[model samples]
Target: MAVRSHSTRVQSFSLSGYHGKPTRGTVTIREFNREQRMRRALEGLGKWWGVALLSVFIPVAHFVLVPSFLLYGMWQLCQRLGTAELATDAHGACPDCGTEQTFELAPRWRAPQPVTCKQCHRGLRLTVPS
Candidate 1:
């Protein structure tokens, strides 16, 4: 009997033609300016507006906006309640093992989902609080 490990697994591929032939082509590497990259990205937006907008704009906007919103919301909340010790994050705790974990905003907005607990290795249902 033999035991196989994932690390030791072999990955093989083949080509139908195995002849002594010269197949060489020039490889060109062209670097684009920031504006060119942006133009190319927007060009992709023409194909799938929703996907391109969501994928490209969301992250860039989030990095520039989420932190600002979170900070301002925290500041206002703290001022209203007159408390300094406070923290806010989109997260849920593992019910089985009581391990807390943060979640992304988009998925958590949809519905409750099962998340694996790092501590007990059990599946726990997590939902964002309204």
Candidate 2:
């Protein structure tokens, strides 16, 4: 057998075929316009800045709002407790003090207990039945 430097094939296929046929050509190379891409990106920086600002602002807004709401909730809780402790039929208030309007707000008494409101000296209504 003799070895030949130039190769030759009998059959040929077009570009779309999956055959291993060979073609002769010098390849062309092209470069990307990177500077143009950079210019385009820089032109859109303002829009990107707005997105960045929103990302930061959203959390900051919630941070401010949540603390304010929490403070308001705590204030309301304090006010409710203060009213429960201080509001009285003692200095001539609360119609149910002497007369039994029904003690719907007081604590439960398991045994015979002497529970009285010091301000009014009137017994509080029992919340739970004995």
Candidate 3:
């Protein structure tokens, strides 16, 4: 097995509410090289395949479980292989409520994404700094 390496950096982002000004924030971005991506894809495949193998022990459920896991593994492998960067963590304050909190971000980093404030339950837009 080849050694897989990845890099991470802190990125600036902004959150805007319908009625409030945009709030500046920071996010942790993880970047994967080709080797890392391949490793991740293979790891995902192996994990799901392991589950599928274990499911074979279950007599009745194996019929559904084995096939489901096998298919899911392939899907995950393709998805991971294509992903180059991911947002792991985000921190910012809600413009509407002025409450500072960590935010949940999607695995694939894309700008102008939609996020909701946990404190105020207000919909906000996350974007990269222009």
Best by the TM-score measure: 3
Q: Please provide TM-scores, in order, for all candidate models, with all chains considered together.
A: 0.25, 0.20, 0.90
Better of 2 and 3 by TM-score: 3
Please report the TM-score between candidate 2 and the true structure. 0.20
Q: Give the TM-score of candidate 3.
A: 0.90
- Cα RMSD (angstroms) for every candidate in the order listed: 24.2, 40.6, 2.1
Q: In model 1, which runs have C-alpha deviations exceeding 4 angstroms?
A: 1-89, 104-108, 127-130
- For model 3, how does the per-residue alpha-carbon lDDT over 1-130 read when each residue is reduced to its tens digit? 7654678999999899988789999999999998889999999999999999999999999999999999999999999999899888799999999999999887788898999999999899999988
Across residues 12-106, which tens digit of lDDT does each residue of candidate 1 receive? 21111123221211111233334444444444434343433344456567565655554554444334333211122334444444545542322
Ten residues in sequence with the least summed lDDT for candidate 2:
9-18
Give the whole-model CA lDDT for all candidates, comma-separated.
0.37, 0.31, 0.92
Which candidate model has the greater lDDT, 1 or 3? 3
Residue 35 lDDT, candidate 1, scale 0-100 = 45
- Badly placed stretches (over 4 Å) of model 2 are 1-59, 85-130
In terms of lDDT, model 3 sits at 0.92
